[model samples]
Target chain A: MNDDEPLIRWQWIADHTAELADYTGIHLRLGLLPVLFGLIISVPLGILCHRWRWLYPPVLTVSNIMYSVPSLALFMIFVRYTGLTEQTVMIPLTLYTLSVLVPNVVDGLASVPEPVRLAATAMGFGAVRRVIQVELPIAVPVVIAGVRVAAVSSISLVAVGQLIGQGGLGYYITRGLQLDFPTPILTAIVLIMLLALATDALLVLAQRLLTPWSRNKVTSA
Target chain B: MIRFDAVSKNYPNGTTAVDELSLELAEGGITVLVGPSGCGKTTTLRMINRMVEPTAGTVSLRGRDIREVNAPELRRGIGYVIQHAGLFPHRTVLDNIATVPMLLGWNKKKARTRAAELLELVGLPAEMAKRYPNQLSGGQQQRVGVARALCADPPVLLMDEPFSAVDPIVRAELQAEFIRLQKELHKTIVFVTHDIDEAIKLGDNIAVFRTGGKLAQFDTPERLLAHPADDFVADFVGQDRGIRRLSFVNAAELPLRDGPVLPATAPVAQARAADEPWVLVVDEGRRPLGWASVAELADGGTLADASLTPLGHTFSLVGDSARAALDSALLSPARLAVGVDAEGAVVGVADACELSAGTTAVQAAAGEQASTEAESASSESRATVGKTSADTPGGGDR
Candidate 1:
């Protein structure tokens, strides 16, 4: 079939199995590493920022600015300095992830009931022990929920990396556009959406596994 | 013993939370710190365990300054309870109670075993040990909080409005349970509350604080009620201070009259021949049934008839306070308080009029004793002054 003759071009897709595998691997890493990095960096920073309290607004403002910057512009701008390597793509994606995850982390930690924290202190729990044993465990559901959003959004943003020639799934859409065919574009969009949905589902499953208690309505004791 | 020696907490915002509060809390008794909101009662209680640091002076527990001990170590040794129980939601009730024991490095099995014992001690069933805090009622959670505090068997307990969050009925039940526990445990406790009645009911020594954080009066509940330090204390104690003072008086001292009492199976003629118009009817076991009227017997009413007036209530002179006896007299249909023994058998009775007279006599006797003691104190001071003058040549210059 000619590139533009049949609408789907299924034969072309089957012949490009190796390319699909390569692109899928790249897409998965591009989407997930930022989330992993974001969580590692943001959670501790969020906890520290929460403790300082005065540091929170400034950190949030900087993150919000980073997140609000267009992904294409951030990637292109970093390309000038980092010379179009994976770092150019990964850095902006990680920044966006941090913006979303940090607030959620802070809010999750803050959501712990004051009385519960007071009780921990009154019961002789030191600051470190209380945070680790009581606060973090209680904050898990909210923190995991934030991660789900970051993962899904980061998956979509990975497609934006195509503007700087590092797009994983979006590489197909770019080629399809260059060739003026609709099949590759449709396939890429479907695959990206599926990846986002799958990642979100995994996060939700992790939340359920981690926090069985939060599922029930907590009556005041 | 916990002693606060001129301890003051002056906030950076220029508000004095606690101002030079000097007080000594006797060992093995409950000392209540109570006042209006923002009066620093809570701060004072917190200072006992170094939760709130004093700005001016020292707070020593058992002769050691609390600041010298590691905070967590000091706190583990001093049990703390607050309003709303403050239980850890993630933990089961057993684990919540086992917190201190676990902190003290007890094995899981031992901590849980002690936790189960405390669950029962606070009047909870053993089955509730596995349940979470939210699964329990507010009152039950408060009980668990108490049990958790007592788990380490700390000699000192600091309770910040512990029962205030529960309903009135539950609060009373918890208060009664608290009193019963204190009777058995005899832990030295410092309780903070806003309710004057709670302080009066639970405190062996009540320290009433003014709004500005000054100690208005520090005295025993009875003495505080009978003789407030100033108008601030008098008003704080409220207009019912006289009635509250009755709780401190002993009902056993009241004169008892064996008013006409008849057996439940007594004949109508025998009831009619009784001296009093109203006759107390007793069962075969000598347990009081109700008050019967001689007039009813005279009107051809048999003892089996249902013309008997119900006994409002009865008081045990052996264990009851004068206030309880007065309450009994006021509640009775015949205006008489029935006195009963441990076996529920009728002993003697007192009318409301007689109780009031007895209370007055008791007060007069107390006043006489107080005056003689004051005169002796003054004379002894005078003798000391005279001795000083005789011994020291500098006294002549003075």
Candidate 2:
């Protein structure tokens, strides 16, 4: 097929509209759950790891190992356990996000000025309250940088889920090769690329809302 | 009243931030902790609220063991302000000021109302309550910080270099505001600053901490200025500390004396005093006219009333510093510049003799302290002169 035409036609997508719907749905579930869950879990762990240097080595080592695993193998390892359900697809992809978030969270927390923390203590903020109110707000830019990287990777990796019984956009690539129908593969690739761009833009919007200080720093400097 | 009972702290890396420090802080007074960096002055202040736990001994507030009370509760009862104000950037100024009160379970509307009132108490406008910390100037942020500390009306306040972040003019203004607030609120205060001048200006009592956490001295500002406990304390206070002490005196206590008066139209002879040759001439309303010598007046011509010998002017010290009076008197071309009231009447004048006499009396009273201090210096100087000094040469040159 030419670059202008996908291996499969738009008519085929409309013809199997129900099948297309199932693919998009599962893809969303697989990437969305893991990234969101991983961020929530790792942020606190990062904060804890930061507070005590003694806890650092173990926490860093686990994240480093997670980063080393390739996407396809990671998905297959989880697939054997859950037997091709959406749970199998979601777990391993989400797990990939931990490595990205933990270090960034720790870095962000570490970047918070010592004077700021002492000021928090002097102003009578106890440990828990100070972290929530002072450290977290100041650390937003660094943490957002991590989330952005993790999120983009997660969206792209949704393609690997096609190896399981549930196929997402990767179905068009595999199916097109078998039948020599290039339209389906080309169209799916275009749509996936667009989806990635749109999601990244949304994250940038979220960053502005969450970290006003970062925006001020950019504008002022 | 706050008291430190031999409190000490040694960090794990073998940094002795504080040595056994014992001192009592009077209720309703500002006790300034002042010294060079790493002097453990900050460590001593932190231990009061248990920000830094002491390795030995304890700090008690109003006779209750601080360790017996819950740390949060103890902190809540003591107001604290620090550099940069540390207002949570995410929160509005109103929310920042209301932090401690909210923790104490104040209702939302009530806490917000109280926070606005506190902003005014610290001399900030009410509209500032809606602005975020980043939106405010350094001075405004500091004021909001002070407001937050006083929100719960805690009986004690702790400040750590609270005005250091702002520019000098703002720092002075904040210092003045704090002094006025101390007069009104009279909370037991432990203020930490490295500036000896600020310590002298703000402290009812000054506690100077040496490096390695030693308490060099603890005494009233007058005594600390008049008689430092040891050489280390004196050097830390600096050679110009006497000049800083000048700020302590009000401008209404010095003695005033009358000078001879002369009329504008009168011949110099009529204006001159026979005994002193030169007499200060006035315009009858007692505003100083000029000086006239008896020789010029004795010539007895209409033109002999020449005002060419105009009195060299100085600030009318009317009733302020003896030094102001003394300085004006010494530099006076008329032997004494005329002191005048708001009405421009010649109130009085002081002469150089008065200044030297007063200086001698003050020195004589302070000299008795010189002997006891000399003995302490001879012994301590031989030991510490080499060890603690980094930039300082053989100590006590001044």
Candidate 3:
């Protein structure tokens, strides 16, 4: 708390390069694994909701309710079952992803043009084949847009997991606050922001590679 | 070949899409089902491929019940084209065309090769194979739709307003290409459209449906125009159908006369001596130059020296229809349709009155033959069945 203390100390960073690298790796895993699991669960759930019209509203409401539970309280609730581990932090983060991922998944599938869907059916595509080949491919751009939002938020939310002992780079953020050292907090915030931006850029690149045909705006005839 | 035996499609909400319809579509010909919106022409067409299942009765394909086959398997055997092209936006033009072939279990290499060939067949350049559907024009997208449908070369093809989405000029061009393709392919096609003109132009047999899913008439386009089955059909065919029927009669059949035709070298006094109000001046090779008013002949000069009114247009005796002759006659400054030979030399001329008489004679003869056929096949439905024969030449020159 000294007024003359520098906001950032260069020596602390140079000395903690190995520790920073380890935390960065841990941060990415904690942030990304949930998104990966969310996608796996959401896609099938979304397809089921799309196939049955009534399922979506209830599913969306429940996921939104789950999302509204404060992340810290969600972490604490999971703590009793899984104990003070990465599982406690990750369990809540995974559930948080459902609110964003499910709607995007539903909206992505809905984005397919009706005519294209009919054409696929007429061309002899079976239900599963059409969903996999035609509908899902067309839904990619919209789904990836959802993924970008989910990914960035997921990465940043990992910092809040610092309340539990399993917070990745969040440990430094809390450490800086407790000791009244500003350097680790600044470095962690900058690193977290950089991770979010880099993940978003990668998702954009993935969307570009996945859907080359969508590059041009479609003109309805 | 496809047959619908008392097929009735009635929805739970009391909408009768198709009612007690019994139709036999001829193989290797285009059978157009045309009517106004809500007339169930589309519903009837879709029932063939089971896109819409019939609530009652049976739809048999080539003597086998279609319900015996799985829906997806049945669809794979029938080609379908729709308005807006409905091409997959995620796939390239070649890949879109290759879809059915790939679904049929053809190797990727073989499927793509067939797709490339179809791209050429549909009159698209090979380079367009790699481009997406959105990158192309509306007309181009339609061509790709047709190419995609034909890739599997199924014996039966169903089209639901395929060309209705394009501009008029492009629609006309696509129509011409479609007729040309039909001649070579001869796949049994069921085309659904609200356009009566398109039905008359492309159909080997036109099935005109009334508002309540009733088949008003199913007959050759010429017969449909000349002898509409009822008031609904007569009105549906349009009041100008008498003029439209002229499209069926060949222009060569019109009786032409050499009246008032004079060589340009004839003296002005000789031109003045012509009985007609205008003298049609001709060049040395007998090609029509222009119409010269007999009263406007100058003093002491040849007919060539007289100021002549331009000839509006001429109908070709070899290829044009009676409609073209009538159009020419109506538009000409001289009120005479000049008929020309293959070399563009003036053969003869006919006024609109003469052209109508000529077309009437052809229609009377055709009507008599149609009536005789109808009488022999006493049942109205029997008379309409499988008459998709040589009459398709109606669109040959168009």
Candidate 4:
């Protein structure tokens, strides 16, 4: 708290490179694993909802209600079960992704043109095969769009998990506040923002690579 | 061959799409089922492939009941083209066409090679193979649809208003291409359409269905136009049926004369001396140059120097029908239908009156032949069997 103290101590950064790398790695895992688990769970549930139609309203309602639960409160509920581990943070983050991922999965499948579906059946494709080979592939662009939103939000939300001391790079923010230092807080915020942007950019690139046909309309005869 | 024996389609909603229908579609020709919407023409076509199962009776393909076969397996063995083309937007044109072959377990290389051949067969360029369906025009997308359907070379093709989605010019082109393809392949085809003219133009035998799913008439296009079975059929066949019937008669049957046709090199005096109001001027190779009004010929110079009017159009004696001849005559400035040889040289000319007389003469001869054929056909079976047999002679000639 000296009047002569600089906003950022550059020597402190050079000295903590290894610790910074460790926290960055933890930050990515804490942020991304929930999104991965959420996707795995949502796709099948979404497909079932799409097939039955009536299943979607209830499933979406449940996911929306789960998302509305305060993330801090969810962490507290999971803390009793998992006891101050990464699981306590990840469990809540995973629940938050469902609100985005499930509807996206359902909408992605629904985006397949009706004529294309009929053509597939007429050409002797069985139901399962058609859904897997044709419907899923056509749904990629829309599904990826949802993934980008889920990923960025999940990455930013990971910092909130510092309340339980499992926050990844968020450890620096709490530590900086305790000592009244600005350097660690600013560095962590910048890194988290960078990670979210990089993940979103990668997802966009993946979508482009996967769905080159839908990138632009070609009106050539 | 497809047979719908006493077939009926009654929905749970109490609508009867097809009622007590008994139809025997001949092998190796186009049999069009035509009627207004909800008449069950599409339902009848779907039943042939078991896309719509009959509620009451059997639909047999080549004498085997279709219901006995697995629906997907049966569909794989039949080619189907629907309106809107229904192309897979995600797949490339070649991969879309390669679908059935690949489903039938064709190797990737073999499937793609066959797809390439069919792309050419459908008159699409080779470079289009790698492009997706959304990149194609409506007409081109339809060509890809046909190629995809024909990929496995299935013996039967069921088309449900396949060309109706395109513009009229494109539809005519597609129809002509369809006829040419049918000529080469000779597959048993069950085509469905709401257009009576389309049925007449492409069908060997047409089955007309009323709005209530009743079979109003099933006969050759020629016979259907000339002898509509009931007032419903007569009304459906339309009031201009006599003119439509002329499409069946060949242009060669009409007598033509070289009366007023003169070389463009001939003197204006020679054209003026002709008894006709207009003289048809021809080039040295005898190709029709233009029509020249004899009264408008100048005082001097050759017929070429005279003010010439364009010959509206010429009908081909070797290829065109009497309907085309009548159309040409009506459009011509000289009021004569100029007949042309295959080499494009002028053959002769015929006016509207002469074309009408020729049409009546051809009709009388056809009527006599049809009666004898009907008698022999009736002796072989009952009245229903006679109707089918009577269509064969006319079908073979076409």
lDDT of 2 by residue, A22-139 (tens): 7666666666678899888887998898898778789889877977888778777877788877777678777788888888889989988776677677666778988887898888
Tens digit of lDDT per residue, candidate 3, span A116-191? 8888999999999999999999999888888888889999999999898888999999999999999999999999
> What DockQ values do the models have?
0.47, 0.23, 0.56, 0.66
lDDT, each prediction: 0.84, 0.74, 0.89, 0.88
Candidate 2 at B270: error in angstroms? 11
Better of 1 and 3 by DockQ: 3
True contacts kept of each: 0.48, 0.29, 0.61, 0.60
Q: Residue by residue across A2-24, what tens digits does model 1's lDDT show?
A: 54477778988899888888998
Angstrom error at residue B55, model 4: 2.4
Expressed as tens digits, the lDDT of each residue in B172-235 for candidate 3 is: 9999999999999999999999999999989988888888787767778887887676778889
Candidate 4 lDDT, tens digit per residue, A71-117? 99999999999999999999899999999999999999999988788
In model 2, the runs with Cα more than 4 Å from the true position are A1-22, A217-221, B257-398
Find the 10 residues in a row with the least total lDDT in model 2 chain B.
Answer: B382-391
Off by over 4 Å in 1: A1-25, A81-85, A179-184, A218-221, B293-301, B360-398
For the record, the alpha-carbon RMSD of candidate 1 to the native fold, in angstroms, is 5.8
Residue B71 CA error for candidate 1 (Å)?
A: 2.2
Instruction: List TM-score per model, in order.
Output: 0.88, 0.81, 0.93, 0.94
Docking class of 1: acceptable
